[model samples]
Target chain A: MTEEGKQAVAKARAILENYKGKKLRIMEVCGTHTHAIFKAGLRQLMPENVELISGPGCPVCVTPADFIDEAVWLATEKNAVITTFGDLVRVPGSEMSLAGARSEGADIVPVYTPIDAVEYAKTHPDREVVFLSVGFETTTPSACLAVQRAEKAGLKNFSILTANKTMDEAYRALKDSVDAYIYPGHVCAIVGTRLTEELTGEGISGVVAGFTPSELVTAAATLVELCSKSDEPFFRNCYPRVVTRDGSTAAKKLVEKYMEPADAVWRGLGIIPKSGMVLRDEYAAFDARKKFSVPSFKAKNPPGCRCGEILQGKCKPTDCPLFGKTCTPEHPVGACMVSQEGTCAAYYQYGGVV
Target chain B: MCVGLPAKVVSIKDGMALVDASGAKREVSAELLDELDPGDYVMVHAGIAIAKITDDDASEAASVMGEL
Candidate 1:
């Protein structure tokens, strides 16, 4: 570390350690930030008055049960191959998870990227390929690109089941819950500071934070300093190199041209209007919902799981009776335990920071 | 799936950039970024290069911390 970096850490530590203001509830909206904080043992440097809460930033954790059921339906009923990021395979749907469906003769392929799924569809013309697209702004552009790639290649076997969501409305829904937010850095890198600036006008204050230890400490300390100095809401971009004022214009244009905002279901927060993104009418042929005519099944959370409350900052992971007892990561009973970014999984893995 | 990996672009051809993240190399879509070069660093998400990034995140944070 540079001398200036050392001084910055010292200053940030002093600010957090000497905090004497009213109990401030600052929520880290990104699951990666929650894990990074625990990995860095950052909670040990803070005063008791400063509390860090986890919000619904993990895409896998916030994905509703019905969406998984829809994927399972495509895999079983339509006999289509379900291509997804590895985490979703274990997440329990209405009847069974994709893993469970796989055991019963359903083909489920886990790939690192949506383009790989498009490639699979290209090679296997006889099998229909449906990629389970679930993420915030950071991963949506890649899915859009995959759709365009499939179209360009004249691959008619490719389709996507989108659970893509926007973070702006979610921030608004969670605005009154905390004093301020620790915004996800990558999301801001794509969407820009304009969203945060708009939130500031509406009295929602926060700092866009990167995943590094130094960046996290600086952002947290900056939040404490700014919040302590004023009663008015403020916005700060700690991750400036990646997140600019306009963000990635090409990425934004790709999503806007291909997808539209629609009402979507969240596990904990329920349905927030226009929070979800679906393929535009022109691209509906690549949509899994239209291609397979997948029917919706009623979704239910496992009994005694407090993932809903934990996601909204109403409770901590330890508050759930099954957090570590029955809901170990090996035998996860809820989506929160199934995802590495999930609050319950982070708390369980790091033995609870607070 | 939301984590962004910082990698150096080893090569670029036909809207695809071959990136190296600590000796592990893969091809990521460069369609979203313009004016990207072979040596520029980028933030890769899933299979796409979202933004051109600084070579060092810590030093960048240090400079911003000076203002804080």
Candidate 2:
């Protein structure tokens, strides 16, 4: 927390006290908020009328099965090198995981950045390197820069499989699920405050939040203020330090130059329109999908996973029968158990749920 | 949420900064930010120095937070 004090807590207590009989169904649509809320025990602190639900914010959790299957296919069938974030490597598809494929001699490397993949491609000229780019607006700029770097270096073997998503579409689809929203702060830092402003302007109570525990508490108190005081939806910024109304112009321009918005398939939410980024035709040679067609196969989630319901804010992780018992983090049965940012994994690790 | 860490800038070369993130040094792009120095603290995310955090900025934000 940036500053530790008793005033914010007292103010939040006052707000919750005022809303004793009224219910505020607020959904936190950011993975960090989910973790922070649980870590701070804010759910336990809030009154019962203050219902805080987790949304489909974790990119690792909401990555559709087919995307993983395609990454696995590229490695197993085409013998191409796979590069991705650590969390994605363990996510289970319908058939196999990238780790499973790696155990079978597939070269899938976990990297801290997309630049590492570019470096790998530069060194291994003979091998086809496909960077599995999975993230939101905050990471999409780096992915674009990597593609630009690879092109500048004249790396013919490098391509990217992008699964980047935008948060606006999800908010649009989930408007009715909650009375207000605690938006993702880091995400808003990149895409700008316009996202939350847009949603709020449309009659959805919302606030952008920072990752700190005290910030979450303060944001909850602010949300109660906005919802109870105004019939009209309003926007509040709890993370004024990092996020601005316009966001990073340079990053946004690069994204516009390299990628275009397309429909994306979220794990629980299914296909949401214009929520994903795809490589532009100008960057056609750097697109792994255009270069090598992944073998098409029917995708399915694990039986009794209930990850879909969890992603949609319809149910909690404990609501699922396999949450802690059959789907522990060590051996995850669903995508939620595979990542620390995931709702189920966070609840299990924190040893409590809302 | 995006994974980020505050790192100290080591050196600049070709519009990239070699930064030390908790003892482990890694090269990240400095294209997204404005000014930088060898010892300045930067918020790095996905191999890019996204923001430069200063004492005034921190305290200003903290004061606002305390007000909440």
Candidate 3:
């Protein structure tokens, strides 16, 4: 093994050995960390008493299916071109996905950056270009900046269909039953560590960890140790190299300047108060909802898909009847299977579910 | 939570900086800082530079990990 790998294993073993025979529950809130834990074979190494549960870390899994239908509608428009990240293309809507619409005659293009969508709008001035803005705080800043750029460049045809959600509200909404939170490392880099102070007084342990196996195991071990000691909240920098107490001030400022806090509907979690963000009134012209005149549509999830339950940490992916038997990645029944960062996708990739 | 990385500013363009993070090159807005340059490491979140990371903090973190 590489030196880093060896050290990571040794550290995990030390943590396990220290917390042996202690009853503790640590929840890893990030889907990437969930994938890393399984991939690193950490579960086999840890004692049975140390339990690690999953949380709503997958942004794609939490995205409501109704939004998917909205994208499909835009794609099928006569002179509308829909652009989105690659992972969102295959997520199933109530009836079909953007991929399905593309199969039938829709102009849905996958672009790397939001700027690419802006360029596409410039090239096809006659066509209305809509970028599907999806993600948490990490990606929202750029998506907001894209809208600001469009406004500056005077691109009249460019607009974004935003379904952006924030993390602070999501964490606040989770029930008090959760013992401790294994925070997402990437999200911490944007919002900074100060935002987590709210959880400190609530007696919840918050440890920001990276996606690597070593980092996750270290975080899990730390959570177990912290929980065993007391109910007091502790913020440890497991991913100190990347995360900081202040977080990304520049990104936060840009997000604040371009976007405003608005209620956004999460697929499983429902409409969290001040959880979603929308373009400010100054940039209202770039807002897709205002620019288009689509009929009112209420999209629902596929019948018997328990993705909502799975997202809330109430059940595992394998607990669903459709898991592996009927709903594979090729034919995903819900957004969990469609997103690369979804927990179901992680479980499927890392041999958790056949 | 948010996901971001600390990257070095390699160049500047249109009030944005071309940053290098472990060989991955991305453009980040430098609207937050005034005295940034090629050798400075800044935390990047969602294509925006959010904070300036100092050499002391980086070394301290590396040392902690090394001890583990």
Task: Provide the lDDT at A243 for model 2.
Answer: 73
- How does chain B of model 2 score on TM-score? 0.79
User: Candidate 1: lDDT of A13?
Assistant: 85
lDDT of 2 at B50: 71
Candidate 1 per-residue C-alpha lDDT over A1-354 given as tens digits, one digit per residue, 9 for 90 to 100: 877777787788888889899889999988888888888888887779988998899999889889988998898889999999997998877788899999999999999999999999989999999999999999999899999999899888999999999888989998878999999999988888998988888999999988888888988999999999999999998888788888889999989989999998888778899999999989989999987788877887688988888888899889999989999888888777878879889889988444
TM-score of chain A of 3: 0.92
Ranking by lDDT: 1, 2, 3
Q: Tens digits of per-residue lDDT for model 2 on A80-152?
A: 9998988898888878789999999999999889988999999999999999998888888889989989999
Worst 10 residues of 2 chain A by lDDT: A1-10
Kindly indicate the candidate among 1 and 2 with the higher TM-score.
1
- Which residue pairs clash within candidate 2? none
Candidate 3 residue lDDT tens string, A1-354: 456556655665676776754566566777666766777777776767876666677667777888888888877763579988776888888878888999998999998667778889989999999999988877787787788788888999999988888877767777463667788777786787887766776666677877556666666666666666666677676777667787767768888988899997877667888988888888878888778865556876677777777767677788888887788888887657777667677677776422
Query: Model 3, residue A178: what's the lDDT?
Result: 66
TM (chain A) per model: 0.97, 0.94, 0.92
Off by over 4 Å in 2: A1-21, B21-24, B36-40, B54-68
- Looking at candidate 3 chain A, the ten consecutive residues that score lowest on lDDT are A1-10
Colliding residue pairs in candidate 3: A186-B2, A186-B3, A187-B1, A187-B2, A187-B3, A188-B2, A192-A247
lDDT of 2 at A113: 90
Cα RMSD for candidates in order: 1.3, 2.4, 3.2
Residue A253, candidate 1: Cα error in Å is 0.7
